[model samples]
Target: MAGLDDITNKAKEFLDSGAVKDALSSEQAEGVSDKLLDGVADAAKKVSGGKFDEQIEGARDAADKKVGNE
Candidate 1:
C-alpha cells in the first residue's frame, strides 16, 4: 500500500521541485496554459449545450490552478 501511495503522487513531487516550478511559471507556459484551459472550457460548454455556463467557468478556474503557472 505504501509503495503504491508513493507511486501515485508523482505530480506532487514534480510540483515541489523548485526548477520545475520555475519552468512552469515561464512566459511560454503561461500562454500554453491559457490556450489549454480556454479550449477545454469552450468544448465543455458546447457539449453541455451552454446550460451549465456558470459551473463550467468554475471548473475552468479549478483546472487552471492545476495546470496554470500561478
Candidate 2:
C-alpha cells in the first residue's frame, strides 16, 4: 500500500509540473498534433527506405487521432 501510495503521489506531482501543464496547454491548436506525427512518420519512412511508408502513415494517422485536440 505504501508503494502504491508513493507511486500515486509521484504521478500527481508529475501531472502538476509546469512542463506538463505547458505541454498540455500548448498542443491544443488544430493540426499541430498531426504535424508532429507527420514529422515522426517521415523519419520512420526514411529509416525504412520507404518500404514501410504506408504502414508508417497509418500509424501516424492513428497517433494524430489519439493525441490531437482538434
Candidate 3:
C-alpha cells in the first residue's frame, strides 16, 4: 500500500503530465464547456429576471481570458 507522501507525489506527477491541459484545449472539450456555461448563464438570467446579464457576461469574459491564457 502507498503511504500518504507516496500518493501525494503520484498525484502531483499526474497533474504535471499535461494530459489535463491537452484535454481542455481540445475542440470537443471547448464545445462542451461552452454549452455548459451557456446553459448555466441562461438559467441565471431567467432566475434574475434578466438583471444578471452583465454579471453573466463578465463571468464568461473572465473564463475566456483564463482559457486563452492556458
Candidate 4:
C-alpha cells in the first residue's frame, strides 16, 4: 500500500511539475503509465494471494484509458 501510494505521489509530482509531458514522448508516457498500473496490479495480486485479479485488471484498464486521454 505504501509503495503504491509512493508511486502515485511520484506520478502526481511528474504531472504537477509538467515534467512527464516534457520528459516522455507520448508513447513513452503511455508505456510508463501502463507499467506503473501493471506493477500495482501485480503487487496487489501477490499480496492478496491472487484473489484480486479482477480488481487489478480493472485498474490496469483504467490506467490505460487515462494515458489515452493524456
Candidate 5:
C-alpha cells in the first residue's frame, strides 16, 4: 500500500510543476473535470476503494449551487 507521505509528496510534485494550474486554465479543464467526476462514480460502483466520483459530484454541485443553478 502507498504511504500517505509518499502520496502527498507525489501530489506536491504535480502542483509544484504548475501542471495543476495549467490544467485549471486550459479549455480542456471543463471536460477533464466532467470526466473526472464520471470516473469517480464508476469507481464507486465497484467494491470500496479510493474513488473521486463523490468528490467530483460534490465539486460540480457546489459550483452549480454557488452560481445559483438548480
Candidate 6:
C-alpha cells in the first residue's frame, strides 16, 4: 500500500507541477492534462477496489482546477 500511496502522490505532484502548462499551448495542455488525469482516475478507481471513489474524484477535480481543463 505504501507503494501505491507513493505512486498516487507522485502522480498528483506531476499533475500540479505546471510543467505541462509551461511546455504546451493552452488548448493542447488542457486536452493532454485532462486525458492524463482521467486515465489516472480510472486506474486509481480500479486499484482502490472502488473504495476511494471520492478521493479519486477529488484528485481529478483538483487537477482540473489546478491545470485547467477543456
User: lDDT tens string, model 2, 10-68?
Assistant: 99999889887566545563367767777888899989999998889888877766553
Number of the candidate with higher TM-score, 2 or 5: 2
lDDT of 4 at 14: 75
Q: lDDT (0-100) at residue 8 of candidate 1? A: 69
Provide the lowest-lDDT 10-residue window in model 6.
20-29
- Per-residue CA lDDT of model 3 for 1-70, tens digit only, reads 4698899998889867788767767777777777777788888889999988999978976775544222
Worst 10 residues of 1 by lDDT: 61-70
Model 4: C-alpha RMSD to truth?
Answer: 7.2
Q: Each model's TM-score, in the order given?
A: 0.73, 0.57, 0.66, 0.56, 0.38, 0.61
**Candidate 5 — which residues are off by over 4 angstroms?**
1-3, 35-70
Taking all chains together, the TM-score of candidate 2 against the true structure is: 0.57
- Higher-lDDT candidate of 1 and 5: 1
Per-prediction RMSD in angstroms?
Answer: 2.4, 4.8, 4.3, 7.2, 8.0, 8.0
Give a tens-digit lDDT track for model 6, residues 18-38: 685565437776788789989
**Could you say which candidate leads in lDDT?**
1
The digit string of per-residue lDDT tens for model 1 on 1-70 reads: 9888887688789779998878777877878998988998999999999999999899888877766466
- Count of clashes, each model: 0, 0, 0, 0, 2, 0
The C-alpha stretches of model 4 lying farther than 4 A from their native spots are 1-25, 68-70
Q: Which one wins by TM-score: 1 or 4?
A: 1
Which one wins by TM-score: 1 or 2?
1
Residues forming the 10-long window of minimal summed lDDT in candidate 3? 61-70
**What C-alpha lDDT does candidate 1 achieve relative to the native structure?**
0.84
